[model samples]
Target: MARKPAAAYPFSSSPGSSSARPPQPNTNLNALRIPVTPERRPGAPSPSSATTTSAASSASRNPFLTPSPGTASASPSPAQAGRSTATNRPYGTASAANSSTHLMPPSAASSTASLVSSSGSSLRPQPTSGNTPRAALSAPPLNTSSKSATTAPPSISDKFSLSPDPSLWGGNLSLSDREADDYLHNPDPKRDRKNDRGGTMFTARGIVNLGCLFIMAAGLIALFAGYPIISFFTTTHQSTQGGYNLGGINQTGQVPEITGALGLIDVQTPAASKSHTGWMDQSTYDLVFSDEFNVEGRSFYPGDDPYWEAVNLHYWETNNLEWYDPSAITTTGGNLKIWLNKTENHDLNYMGGMMSTWNKFCFTGGYIEVSVSLPGDPTVWGLWPAIWTMGNLGRAGYGASLDGMWPYTYESCDVGTLANQTQNGGPPDALTTGDPDWNGALSFLPGQRLSACTCAGEDHPGPQDSSGNFVGRAAPEIDILEAQVYQSTRTGAVSQSVQMAPFNAYWQYTNTSNADFQIYNAEITEANGYLGGVYQQAASSVSITNQNCYSGHQSGETGCFAVYGFEYEPGDSGYITWINNGQPAWTVYAPALGPDANTGIAQRPIPTEPMYILANLGISENFGAIDYAELVFPVYLLIDYVRVYQKQGSTNIGCDPADHPTAQYIQNHIDAYSNWNLTTFDDFAAVSGSTWPKNKLIDTC
Candidate 1:
């Protein structure tokens, strides 16, 4: 913006220029420099004196030399008629200031480098009291461009008027970024100039502009105030395009701004075969899950929820995976046995585990993979410990199969009977229509399931062999069958992996993954085709969708589903996952299977479909311990290393069939909370049963 036919304001010499002639080029840089720091000694060659020599050398060296004797005559150097001007310059060294050495003003730089008019005319010298003007001009132009061209050191005291070079302060005083922004991006500078002042210091016009800005700001603010849904997209676009680092979780919700829409969920795993300990809940983690499971009799002891458990646990797991750990169960370094006394242990070993709101925790839809590392042990045998999710669902006989719909009933369902339905081929094909234990005898055999726990009359749900009678609290098996999310680890839920086994054991090696360590992952159903932008999806959208009518493209269909599928990346995201031998992980989708759920162009499910998540960890025999568990859907605990990413511009579009799309999950519920176990990043620490201690859910700030 330095407008100039004036050759870009080539050089503006002040009235105090000392050189009578212009210097030629070819001068060494060292010739022109002043002492750089405080160490420069006094009586050193003065920059003014050096300038005199360099100018002579400059004039003698180059053919392009030009001089302005006339201009130099009009303006003598300030030192010639010493005048003090600076108001706040700091004091300088006494010797440097008072010695025979001609001193450069502490405030102003040496005035010897002033450029001559370039006309090559000799300047009319000022009438010196003793010396003749001709005598001053006689020294062969003083080699105008001398080899030692010098400029005086800047004044460090409050003596001389100040003048600084452009380089001294390049980026310090910016035209207020906002004002500059208005000037740059906005074409109208009048209102902007007015508002610019208003933003800093108010004026009449600034106030008016301020009022207008407030109105506009209010309108912009109203655009997505409570409407987390639309706010996610717009704000995300703004943050990314404007250059901001966004959080993976915060992108879905607001950070530093607490909203029911952004909270964690509480999930409890079934007790280990030998020890009964449930999954971690969200309340402890200072977060809330969307969908929650109802427990008959469970105890909550203060902060024993999600928050405290979120502490980095490298030491806990490092010392816990015992040398002879049974394949079934996971052991940790932070031994729970010593930390929690008898009273605490009693509280830790609960009868039933509770679930949080599913809608609140996980993404409504997309592939969420949980990375897990299974202990290579054959002795673990017969352990089925699963990491699955559950939600409320109802089926209406054959009506749900072809018509692509299921009715929501307010009635509680039979846990076993509910399990019988909600499977491929509607019972007869993949599941049993009646009691396979009574009717088919061995027909109910667990296929490759080491932890089936079938002991003749044991197939029935109600009575325990030791307890006798068939009567027991009947809860619908709705979870097992209706559960659409799952993936298995390399081991089983047989009594061996998750519980203690009483016998000499050997760690078995198996590249083969069993059904016991399975997990179920499913995403949420939203109002339209899907939630989230093509590249950067937002959780806020789903949260504010119904409440604020803020949704993405193609709104209007109503099944609210979220993403809870299993992670299947290799090496980096993890070597092993919930299912497969860390390969080909199985993800269950109702009405969508095989090619349909495969994530190809043809497999995308449309419309809003209500969905939930579930996993099954079955233990047939007692396990010595569970090495570790995987959570398909993400939670703060299940991550190897979480990275918050924000993209600029509008690269985000819609769902991608090539890869599973992460849809926004309503963060308002508890059951939707999935685990993002950070243990995934932990350097596998070798531990023994003696050092391994389980974590007792401790809820604390």
Candidate 2:
């Protein structure tokens, strides 16, 4: 690493320094130095010469350095004449034996700029008889290689360093070892003033030059300290509030700032609002669902588990090397650990864990927050851990629904025999004008869509036809956070995205060309339709909650946790606001369904169906290629807690009577099945013994 250069020596022009003004022949001339009197060049139309001559002629009663007609007539008082004695000639021209104090006229010392004329004119005037030649006053060529190192260009180290080395400056005399050490190390003005015998000697021009250099250095330091923050709020020229221009990704891959209504707005809360666990709380919202992962030393599996149900994916999705296993899920020390371990499972070399609340917990529009920390740095090859939710039309048991879609048959489920449950009801006909019912044999109810399936044969029925069991042909998929840091090296930039796939007509077209579906970096306006959304990315060093925490993890160690959330209000084209670090960062809304104003493509309205929360740690080849042997065994995705909140008195479609018969469902069916506690934000805080404040406003919109 390059070190900062030593401080430059304070520029104090003395007799020894060529840049110094000509030495005074006596104390009388010392008082004459206050006025800026540049020597007049003969026949030159210089303003400085006229000022100097006029000042001398008028101030003859005062001690003047120049010989003027006014001074010749005025005889100085006896005391003034006695004190006008001198020790040496101007510019040290006196001989050793005879120290005659002959003062050179002020016209000898011309402006430095004029001294170095393009034509080789002498800097000093010719000497009078019995005086030294003008050549004696001229400074010699700088000899950098000499022992004193007088007047050298700045060394390579000094030029590139944060500060300029003082010894290299031409006007400053070469300091001795003791002087250099004292000036560089003890920079206090008191010490400098003490060492300065003839008081401050900096000329006006020298002070101005020093001021300019200080300003430039300050600017550079400010830019270095604030680049991350400035970059986060800068967007491409095409980007605007509520609109994203994915014409191309920046070469730096920076995420653009969100603007307009889509930008973050501070929702003022009550004066005594609480801030517990570093989360600002508002009073208007209620805590409906939360999995604090307080259950210790046990895995949340079937029978007796209160919050989550483990699902075995059986190595049929994402071309992942791991099989989803219940054994890999564990709760310890107030945290949920989803371990990704390398092992032989169902003919797969790796096994991971996943859980969901498909039937147990589901809700419509509200806020969902997950506190999670992931494993591995941005370049950790292939690691895909996500906290997401899927819309649920089937499991909601809206009408004749049995835990919705095709879930693995569970004996405890109240939906009678698995085969006897209600079949696929198909897409909502009113959602569009003759919507294709895209799933065909797959259930029209929304659920997590895996890349593979194998539970049923080729020619199966409505819920589970042979086309590899079933497919999701339902509501949108909200990928709250998905990171692909594997694309960037540890010290390089890290990138992640927030994605939503509305299973509408536009989705059909975009999914066909999935490679170009991403929005990159901007806020999505309602004009983009429900099927599309804005994208965001950040440098690994900048903290962008949930994906990476810039402060916690440094070096190659990846141990980061942060809050990620979203709010959905079903009105005016269905508003959805994405949040990070408890701040509403961006928002997207449903667009006019069928034939957009700009693209003219038929789009689907944002699905009004409820969705169930799901958290999974899946190893996917889609993130990037990975080697099984290179995988870090026992890597885990640690979830501190998962929470969901909603505005009070909102319709509980997930538990409304029109949905299912509660009496036949789990005990305290609404609370048990949904894992939701209905209470005001403050009430919930009291119950949980937390001082954290809750949201007071209704919506970021």
Best by lDDT: 2
Off by over 4 Å in 2: 1-283, 394-475, 486-559, 592-603, 627-630, 651-701
Instruction: For candidate 1, write residues 232-334 as lDDT tens digits.
Output: 7667331211111111222223332222322222233221211211121111111112212222222121122221111111112212211111111111321
Candidate-wise lDDT, in order: 0.22, 0.40
Model 1 TM-score on a 0 to 1 scale: 0.22
Question: Tens digit of lDDT per residue, candidate 2, span 8-87?
Answer: 11222233344444333333211111111122234634334433343344344334332334453343332232122122
The prediction achieving the highest TM-score against the true structure is 2
RMSD (Cα, Å) for all candidates, in order, is 29.7, 30.9
Worst 10 residues of 2 by lDDT: 533-542
Q: How close is candidate 2 to the true structure, as a TM-score?
A: 0.39
Any runs in candidate 1 off by more than 4 Å, and if so which? 1-357, 374-378, 382-384, 391-433, 438-582, 586-701
